[model samples]
Each structure stands twice: as structure tokens, then as C-alpha cells.
Target: MTLPIDPTALAGLVSRQIRTGERQGMPTKIAIAERTYATDPDDLWNALTDAGRIPRWFLPISGDLSVGGRYQLEGNAGGVVEECEPPKRFAVTWEMGPMISWLEVRLDPAAEGTTLELVHEAPVDPDMWKQFGPGAVGVGWDLGLMGLGLHLDSGAAVDPATALEFPTSPEGMMFVRTAATGWADAAIADGDDPALARPAAEATLAFYTVIPEEGTQS
Candidate 1:
């Protein structure tokens, strides 16, 4: 499928970061991704929070979205809205099965446009961290950010079929590979050994781009 933007250029749009931190005294790893959208803060905020608009770029979401309410992202994570500040920021608990994490999204008016920053912090699973680094979640958000950009630019929903097929496509593979490398670099900057981070990035790339055989799960 044809991508709405250049794969490499789209991959470069996000700024990635890794922060070593703690939540409730438990060691956690934070994955940060930021991008500037050529739209006003209000529009960007609406696109992010409006139920009708969410599936256009992100996922099908259903629930009461106000503070302390619950929300589920169809087949993905479900959580409670912890805080909400219109056209500015919001925080939520990101829970998938038994695992729980914290997600905060902030929108700031910038000279060029509105900058969207997503911060995802989860307790570290040492083995998973050693295997995938931040790219496990980072690359997925990279795709979401890419979809948002396309939706915002075209003022329309990104084709769901294309979005689903992207990761294993040649262009999608390139984007994932590039995003994984960027996350690895962020990990390295955050003091993870380069030797380990590089391999972890490769593992991340494989995880995202590998296609499963028919009737099998990925």
C-alpha cells in the first residue's frame, strides 16, 4: 500500500527518549515520543480526545473518558483517566491484562505548530528490557504518531487496512527499523550500554516487522 508520507521522513518526525525512573518505588522505564503537528492545539487536542475522531488516527476507543473514567482501546490497552486538562494535557493508567503502566500526553503551542508529547512509563521487566529496550513500546507509538500525522494532514481517517498491513510491508519495515534504531540511541544516551542496546534494537525490529504464518499468532 502507498504511504501517505515518505517512510524515512515520517520516521524522523518523532523525537525519542528513554528515562530511568521509578513509580511507587518500583523501578520503571519511561519511553518518550514527541512530534510537532502543523495544527492548532485545540484541533490536535480534539483529535486526541474526541471519541468520534480517535479511531481516525489511533484506535477504536469506548468508555467514559472524563477524569477517573474508564476507556478501552479495542483489543489493546484499557485504563482509567487519571487527569485531564483541556487542550493541554491528560494522564491515564495504561493497563493490558495484568500489566499496568502510566501514560501522559501533553500538547503545547509551538512556533511551527502544536507539539504533542507522549510519555509511557512502565515497571521494568528486566528480561524484556534486556531483549527489546524501549522500542517495544516506542515503535508502536511511532506508528500511532505517523497515523495521527496522516489523519491531521488529510483531515480524514487513515485507511485501517493499510495501517494494519504496514509493519510488514517494505516501507513499513524501513520505518520500524529506523524507529528502533532511534530508540536504541535514546537508550544509549540514557546510559544503557551500546553493545546491549544495539542488539535489543535489532530484536525490536524483528518483533515489529515479522509476519506470522497463516493461522498462527505473532
Candidate 2:
């Protein structure tokens, strides 16, 4: 089944910025492209917190979702929920590490729909982040948001793996290519040398095999 939203538009919706590390010897900071969806805050909140709803777009997530509650995403890492305020904000530990990469999501009610904001914060590890990059996680979230939008609008059920495969399809490949370019732009904006950003972004896309073009971007 095809989705109503344009994959290219969804790929381009991300807005990102990078922050220099505060502490001496600390790694640089990484953030994702923030996206806002047109929907209701209450509906958005349910999409994020309800286990039954999560797997439709995102992974199979199992978590208490309450403040200080620990949670896990099947086949992925586990962490604790640091903050949870209904229909407003939710934050959680993303993976196992002292660095404590975290994800924060916020929802604001609007006349047209709910505006959703997502922030992923973590220390920079050139090698690691390059392997995953924003698209790795960002694409996943993009699929999740799409699924949520459909679920709220039409009672549709999306399989996480199938949604993820969207990027590998012909249309999905276009989205992935554009998203890679967008991330490269973000890397450049963050003060990364073009030399570094170019290679990293190419490598990242290659790692995910999302782009179906003849030659690798790198």
C-alpha cells in the first residue's frame, strides 16, 4: 500500500543543528532534523506512548513510558524514560552508555493539526555516528510519523519492517537520496569539513543501502 504523503517531502522535512561539546576532551554534539506533523497533541501522544500503536510505524517498543521508567525496543537497545508529560513532552535514554544519548519529543496543538518536534542528543563519535547518522534513525522516525499519520486518519496498520522498506523502493530511494543530501547539508552547516561530510554521508547511505543509484555517493 502506498502512503498519501510524498516521500521526498517527508525526507526534506528534517531540520538539524550541531553543538560543540561543552567539556574539554568531550566529543562534539549531534542532533537530528526536527520535524513537525499536522495532527492533534492527544493523538500524537497516543502514537508515541501506546505500545499497540508504536509498532505500526516504528519498532516493537516496550516501555513503561512514565517518568523514570525503563523501556526497551525489541531487537534494539534499552533505556530509561527521563521525562513524560502527557500530550506535551517525553524524553528517554536511547542506548547503553555513559554518553546517555537521549530522545525528546514534544507535541503542540494547532488549528490544522498537532505540531510534533523531535530532538536526539548525543556526543559525537565520528566513526559511530557516521555508521548510523541521522538518516539511520531519522528514516526510522520518518516511517513512524507516516504510520502515525495514517493510523490517526484512517485506522491503518503498518508493519515496521514494511514501512522501513519504503526507502528501498524506487520512490523510497528518491527520498533516501534526498535525505542523504539533506544530512550532508546539515553536517556542513555544523562546521564539518566538506571533505568529512561528503565521505561520511556517502558511507552512511552505503551502510543502509537505501540509495539504489548505480555508483555510491562517496
lDDT of 1: 0.94
Please report the candidate that would top lDDT against the real structure: 1
Could you say which candidate leads in TM-score? 1
- Name model 1 segments beyond 4 Å from true: 215-218
Candidate 1 lDDT over 6-97, as tens digits, reads 68888999999999999899999999999999999999999999999999988999999999899999999999999999989999999999
TM-score of each: 0.97, 0.81
Please report, as a residue range, the 10-residue window in candidate 2 with the lowest summed lDDT. Answer: 16-25
The digit string of per-residue lDDT tens for model 2 on 1-218 reads: 46644768766666655555543556646565555656677777888889887776666878676788888888776799888889799888788545567787888776778777777766667776656555555555555556676666665677555665665677666666667667767767877677766776666566555444677542
Off by over 4 Å in 2: 23-25, 96-99, 129-134, 210-218
* Candidate 1: residue 138 Cα off by (Å): 0.3
Q: Alpha carbon lDDT of residue 142, candidate 2?
A: 56
